[model samples]
Target: MISLEHANRIVGATLEKGKALGLKPLTVAVLDAGGDLVAFARSDHSSAMRPQIAMGKAGGALALGVSSRTVGDMAADRPSFIASLGPISRHGVIPAAGGVLITDGNGTLLGAVGVTGDTSDNDESCALAGIESAGLKAKN
Candidate 1:
């Protein structure tokens, strides 16, 4: 279960990591196992669209059981199918990096964390750091 507290911890850690790395302002979103938003945070100077992008990444991770980076790669290979997915999934399918699935010690899926604002690799690193800080596993 992804409680609000857990979700917030992930967001805080992600934001702090980005700050420490001197990355751009970030927006983070956490989603529960049921694919519902549980927590979110946006740093100063971040774009207004960041929150939406974060949510899309989180939703995409939960829906596909993989990181949004993987989704982006897959989409690149299947543009037409991926294009149709946006509307079919109600815009939940964002093919980008920075989204990662969260799992417990036993590797049970708990939820996901999504980050935006920096380069895709940096954003993913932040999300992974957050998940690890929460003493959870990051899958995909």
Candidate 2:
């Protein structure tokens, strides 16, 4: 099962790290094995777009059973597939940055985390912190 406590802690950590970096307020999300949101948070001044962006990343990870970044890179070579993903399982097709696969040492799927409102690299760093906090690793 997904860990709600871990989810909350991760989002909180990501937000704190983002704020420390002076990045814009963001939306963060934790999704379960099914890609359903386990936890979600939005920082002050964050726009409505943030949540969906984070959700898209989480959804993409759960649906593809792979890191969203990989999906994005593959889409670069096949834009049509990415386009087609829009109509398919709405939650299953996310392409934005900040989505990452969460896995344990055994490589078992734990779920995913998604962050938005910052550059891809910054979002990634925040995610890295949270994943590490949970003693799990982000699958790129």
Candidate 3:
């Protein structure tokens, strides 16, 4: 389980990293173990679609129990099967970077953090930083 406070901290850290790096404004999302949103933040000037993109990344990570980067690879290898997932994931799954799984010191899955509005690598890095800022490990 991920506490709301923890989610908030993660989002804050993720957004701060984007700002510090002078990247485009970002939308960050934190999800609980069950893939429900726990906290979210979108920076000003970010595209309207950013929130949905961020949520998709988080939900995709939670559903697969792996980083979205891995999902992206899987999708790339099997486009048809990945496309079939569309109906199942009402919130959608973005099989891309920027989504990372959150784990505890004991390697238990806590949740996930997703970042958008920057390059895939930067978004992923920011999400990892957010997880690290909360003293959690990112299973990416």
As for TM-score, the candidate ahead, 1 or 2, is: 1
Candidate 2 structure quality by residue, lDDT tens digits, 1-91: 5688888888888888888899988788998877778999988888777787888888887788777777788788998988788678656
In model 3, state the lDDT of residue 28.
95
The segments of candidate 3 whose C-alpha lies over 4 angstroms from its true place after superposition are none
Deviation of model 1 at 36, angstroms: 0.8
Among these predictions, the greatest lDDT belongs to: 3
Each prediction's whole-model lDDT (CA): 0.88, 0.81, 0.89
**Poorest lDDT segment (10 consecutive residues) of candidate 2:** 89-98
**Pick by TM-score: which candidate is best?**
3
Clashing pairs in 1: none
Clashing pairs in 2: none
Candidate scoring better on TM-score of 1 and 3: 3
lDDT of 2: 0.81
Q: Give the per-residue lDDT of model 3 (tens digit) for 1-140.
A: 98998889899999899889999998999988888889999999888899889988888888777888998999999989877875798557898999999998999999888899999999998998899998898875
Per-residue CA lDDT of candidate 1, range 1-140, in tens? 88788888899999999989999999999998888788998888888789888988888888888999999998999978876777766337888899999998888899988898999899999999999888888985
RMSD of 2: 1.4
